[model samples]
Structures are given as structure tokens and as C-alpha cells.
Target: MAPNDTQVSFALAEPPVETAPAPAEQLRTRFGTLTIKPAHKLEMPRGPFGFSDYTQFALADVPNQPASQFRILQSLEDTEVSFIVLPTAADNEWIGTADFEAACASYCFDPTTSGLLLIATMRRDTNGQVKATVNLKAPIVLDTANQLARQVVFTSDAYTIRHPLEL
Candidate 1:
């Protein structure tokens, strides 16, 4: 019967509602408009050669590519910065008969989950012909799951930086 022991609960004020962050959108580069789904965006921890400024890139599929495994890596920062990349696993003849998995392990990479080993190719020369070489010594490993990527360099002489791209 004594109301002195218990305190009555009361609410006269409301808390502010929090807003959710906006969804990520595809970055448009000079190459062309890109539309990389949220899950397909590849995040490069260390940008490519001389490209220390930009890290974000989208894997864009090119029509009538030299090979079915070839794709375009469009830089979101600079429109002029784009690389023609190909997965080594897609065609062994392109990279050679080296131990691809061993090369990944040498760089502390996991072949099973690291997505794919992509070799970067020069866009083209003044001759208007595709560069007849690809970087076999170093490959860009795309971590599709975490959207992360890194360029791993191999010291072995087995692979060359400019292997003739007969394609």
C-alpha cells in the first residue's frame, strides 16, 4: 500500500532516429560508364604501376575480347587509366606451364579463395596494335570475396615481364 518504495516510470522525450548509409554506386571512368555490382567490385590494396593515387577499379567485360578470359580493369579515379587483364588459369598457354599454384603460395596467396590470377596487359602502342606482351612475372590477384586485390611479383626467371602475346 506504501507507494514510497517503488519509483514510477515515465517517458516525455524521444531519441533521434539514425539513418543508414547510402549504397555504393559504380564509378564512371573516361573509358566508359561502369556498372560493377556491389559484390563484384575489386579493391586493390596497392594500386598498379605508377598508379599509387587510385585504388578502386571495376572488372568490366569487353565485347569481342582477344580471349574469353580477358576483361577490362577500369580505374575509377582517372579515365585514362585502364588495363586489359586476363586470368592465367583461363589459358595456361598464355602464361606458360609453370606451377601457377606454387607461384601464388610463394607470395603467400591462396589459390582456392583468392579469386583469379590476372596478368595485366598494355592497352596499346602508337602502332594501333595491342601490346604483344603481358606481365607474367607479376600478376594481380583479385580477392573477389572481400573485394580486395594485390599485385604479386615473382623473382623467378621462369616468367618474363613481356611475354609475347601471340593472340
Candidate 2:
């Protein structure tokens, strides 16, 4: 049959069985009804400073228009607590700054790294008007390989501990 034909049928293929093994369990967390996949988990090596007690967190997808927002779901025993996730700057201009870029480079995070700078939102404001701030000085830097992470503190006075999320 021609490529345009939708009625073409071929039955020579053996029953498809385990052609691709399941993805590694990357983001395993007992949050919500579903157990999140491993890829979604952000590796917190020392865990969050204040939240050192609970290390593993699931960064789940946030449902809404404007795709920037996400849910940083934390597991608290049988209960799951989720925080809104937002970037420090709406635009990545600050990343180009010498100090910021240098800090990232020291951690071997080049421009090609799939690094995500996320801040846990305090409230779930559907209106999206709530003040979204990021911990600039102490940012969570994750090493995509081996799922390792560390919260590094940048001494640059250029940034702030809480910077307003501007569009």
C-alpha cells in the first residue's frame, strides 16, 4: 500500500513483549493516589536546609494555562503536601550575570545542562496574583546525573533571598 493508504495491514511481527523495559523508578514518592515516576524527582543531596527531615520530593505537573507553574509535592507520611513551583525570574536575564553564571559553572552546570531553578510557592493561588518569590541566595542546584543535588548559597549581593517573580 502507498504511504497515504490507511488500510495497509502486515502480520509478520511477533507479539510485542518487553521491547523496552520500564523506565527506572526515579521519582518515587507516596504523594497522592499515584506513585510518581523517578524522572520527576529533584535530587536533594543534603535535602532542603529547613526541610532536611524530608528529602525526596516530587515535582508534579501543575494544570492550568501559563505552563510555567508546577507543583512541588512533598510527602508527609500518608499525607501529601504540594507547593506551587515558579522560576526566580520570568526571563533568564539574571542567569547571564557574571556571578550567577560563575556559581553555576563551579558546579559544572554549563548552559547545556537541563537545570531548572524552581521555588516552592507558599500558597495555591489559582488567580496567580499571589506574590511568588524565589530563594535567590540559597538556590537548589541539582546534578541531573545520578540524581544528586545541593543547595548552594551565592554570596553575590546582586541577588536577594526573596525576589519577586516578575513577568
Candidate 3:
């Protein structure tokens, strides 16, 4: 056989490797349960708001009922103080600030696939009527595929920390 023929035969003889997919990440929280991936956790550089000392977190699944839907969840050491997440869908006319893009850029998270946005919150009253707001001005931008994250602030005046969900 010619040299080229031998190379071709060798290439055809090798079989492809088969592997099983990795298991999903599941974390238990005080508010609820969350099914996430190890790559989905975004550690805050300086930590988040009051939980600056707490770095570890897990994104929990929100079972959207007859009311609003939750897109993500944030777990802290307390577990009882997890934050509910919401997506900034275009239909909601949610516009990000200019700094938002820069924050993602710092982490090298592409805007295309890393377009997912998340917000967190806390409840002040037991009735769930009194609720504090999250910082929408600086939202946590996460790249789900890579499990990378960063807090990005929008320079635009459109987004604010007090943008009520009612609107």
C-alpha cells in the first residue's frame, strides 16, 4: 500500500470515544430548592450588598405559578435570605445601562449568549407585603455556559434600583 493509503486506513480504524453527560447541580435553600450547574455560580468580586462576606451562591428554579415568574435564585450562608430572580425580557421594555455592557466585557462574557440578566430581592414582612428592592442599576450578569459572572452597572438613566415590578 502507498504511504497515503496507510494513513487513510489508520484514520478510519480509530473509533470515536463515548462519554456520559455531567450531572446537574442541585442546592438546598431556605426559600426553596434549586437545580443548577456547578458552572452557573457567579462569585461576586467584593461580594453582594450586605452579603459581601458571603461569596458562594446557587441559582434556584422558581416555579412560576398564577402570579409572576422567577428566572433565578441566589443562595447565601443564611439560606433564609435567598433572593428571587427575574429576567429582563424585551417585552418588559427593560433596557440595560451602558455600564452593563462594560461589566460583562470585564468578565469576557459575550452579549449574545451571555445575554441573561438576573435580579435579587428580600422580604421585610412576614406577610410578604413589605419587600425591599434589588439593585437593578447594577445587576448580576452571568454566563450560564461558562458559569462566569460579574456585577454590571448600566450608565443609562433608564434602569434604577427602584423600578417597581408593577410597571
Candidate 4:
């Protein structure tokens, strides 16, 4: 999914006496408390590759790192279930290729408007240094217009599940 660059504003208005107070919109996560808005919520029909049980998620910006390339795909079903993702630009070399377009098309996604996010995994090396890698083979494709998403797997060998990050 793409990084949320737009700021959402809520109007300050008192509720009518006849209506009850709205349910809390705040979601407490490992990252912190996030204001759960409809705009930021995503519905995964098939969920991720292995986590089909939990289909609902929220695309949240990394707390205290607005300029960072990473985003959090927080599972609404389970507060502890979350994944770090990297949004791929439309002009990205691999994403702009015909193969990538075909992959997206097979899943009924429009390459031009669909947003792609690579799942990131981090590990510690022998030297006690941390390294990060992204799964290029399997990416979460987001239908931004409908707030729907699905994890698509590319059959081509060009992509790797553990594409190392520069860090």
C-alpha cells in the first residue's frame, strides 16, 4: 500500500442529546495508539499468504518516522499481528515492467492505480548487526479506490522473497 501522505481532519462538533456517544476510535498497538479511521482501514479478501484468518488491517505510518519508507500493516483482528511494509512507487523498475503488470492483471488489479507493498523482515547477523530484507516475490497489492487488498505471488524467478535492504 502507498504511504498515507494526506492528513485527515475531524470537525469538532458536539453530539446531539438524542444520540449516544460514538464508540472509541482509538486502537492500541505495539507501535502505539492509532486513531482508527475508515479511510485508513483495508479489507483483505484472502488475507496475506499464510494469515488468512485475519483479513482486516490498517495502513499506518510509522510513528515518529513520517519521512521513512516503511509503513505498518496492522492487523485489526489481532493487535499483536503487524507487518512492516515498503511501498513501491509506480515508476519502480520491476513494478513498471510488463511481467509485473501481468501479475497484477491476473488478480484484477489496475497497475496504474493499485498500490504495492513489500513485506519486510529483519534479522541479526553473526556480527551482531541487524539487516532487513523485503519479499519481492509476494507483495500486498492494494486497490486504493475500494480499500481492498490481497497478497499476490509472482511466478517469475526475477523476484526474491528475501531481497536484502541496504540499511
lDDT per residue for candidate 4 within 1-167, as digits (tens), equals: 23244322211123345766455467789988766655668889888978899999988778778766787889999999899988775446554467667766777877666667789988999998989988988888776656778888878788899988776
Q: Of models 1 and 2, which has the larger TM-score?
A: 1
Which 10 consecutive residues of model 2 have the lowest summed lDDT? 5-14
Compute the lDDT of residue 65 as modeled in candidate 2.
Answer: 32
| Runs with alpha carbons beyond 4 Å of true place in candidate 2 | 1-35, 63-66, 71-82, 87-91, 96-111, 120-129
Quality of model 4 by C-alpha lDDT:
0.74
The sequence of per-residue lDDT tens digits that candidate 1 reaches over residues 1-167 is 00222321211112233665335465566545655444445667678767878798767656434234456777777778888765444124434434556655655655555534455555577888876567777777654445667776767888788776545
How well is each residue in 9-40 modelled by candidate 2, as lDDT tens digits? 21111223556634533333433343444555
Cα-based lDDT at residue 51, candidate 2: 65
Location of the lowest summed lDDT over 10 successive residues in candidate 1 = 1-10
Error of 1 at 53 (Å): 2.1
TM-score of 2: 0.58
**TM-score for each prediction?**
0.63, 0.58, 0.61, 0.79
- Best-fitting candidate, measured by lDDT? 4
Enumerate clash totals for all models, in the order shown: 1, 3, 4, 0
Off by over 4 Å in 1: 1-28, 63-68, 90-109, 115-117, 120-131
